[model samples]
Target: MGSTILPTGMVFASEQNITENSSYSSSDNVGVSIQKDENGDLMVVKTETKARANVARWGAWQYTHIALSTGVTAGAINTAYSKGIGSVLGIFGLPGWAIGNLLTAAGWTNYGNSPGNAVARLWDKNHNGWVGFYKRTGYDGAGRAVATAYKTE
Candidate 1:
């Protein structure tokens, strides 16, 4: 009779090893106030805007490497339009189209229905508004990679 041997190199830990480098606590006075006007109406009003600044946004573009087959009907054009609009608007609202165009011009093309990725950072100060966009290519299904940050204005 021969004895069988099991493979080695397996290690397991019952608990995770974690270290806390710093802990912070604060003790400060906090207050809240509420006011009502005539007819018991709330005094403060809140409003929202469609587009603002200091928002970091991201978008992906996908162009099919292969063209549509002949005699094959595609879906409604509105679907693609809406998709583009929604993707862009998710970051910059109506101005996303302009930013998208800029990205296309900067080597982010829709060739073969493939789109290049674009990102933008918007900021405003003293009633002045500014938009910055970044475009890149060659991100097809590879493993994780490091991103290099560059300053743009």
Candidate 2:
């Protein structure tokens, strides 16, 4: 007899018969079956399955970078504003000048120099400083996510 072509592109010749104890198995998330048609022809059946899993996505890296950069920029701006305010207050006299100097120094230490150094490191491209900054931000974001998830539980 001539070979019969199955819908799945498998060809079965009439002389070849499926054994009675034929079995099918799948290791993946799928189902497999072997059956016979009305004409005693072997048929292979397959069932497709989709497996779903809840996984942590790394899409927050971009946001983390943006946030870090924004924080640094805002720090710089705030420091400059405070310096301006301090300089204006210094014109008032001795105690005012002392307080102004204190504010200026605090602002420089808290916002200006520290954040400026970070920004410089981020833009230095010659060194791996950018990687360090990005990695720190990524770690911070991942830590926050874990902490928040734990708190909700």
Candidate 1 differs from the real structure by a C-alpha RMSD in angstroms, to one decimal, of: 24.4
Q: What TM-score does candidate 1 reach?
A: 0.20
How high is each candidate's TM-score? 0.20, 0.18
Error of 1 at 133 (Å): 3.9
Worst lDDT 10-window in candidate 1: 24-33
Candidate with top TM-score is 1
User: Tens digits of per-residue lDDT for model 1 on 1-153?
Assistant: 011111221111121111233211111101111122223311111111222122132123222232221111012112222344333333332222223222222222222232221211111112122332222121213322211111112
Per-residue lDDT of model 2, residues 1-153, tens digit only: 112222332222222223555533323213333333233333333332231222233222121232123344335324434444333332322222222222222222344334445433333334533311121111132332211110000
The reply for model 1, stretches above 4 Å from the true place, is 1-82, 92-94, 117-153
Q: Which pairs of residues collide in candidate 1?
A: 63-113, 63-114, 63-115, 64-113
Candidate 2 Cα errors over 4 Å, as ranges:
1-18, 50-153
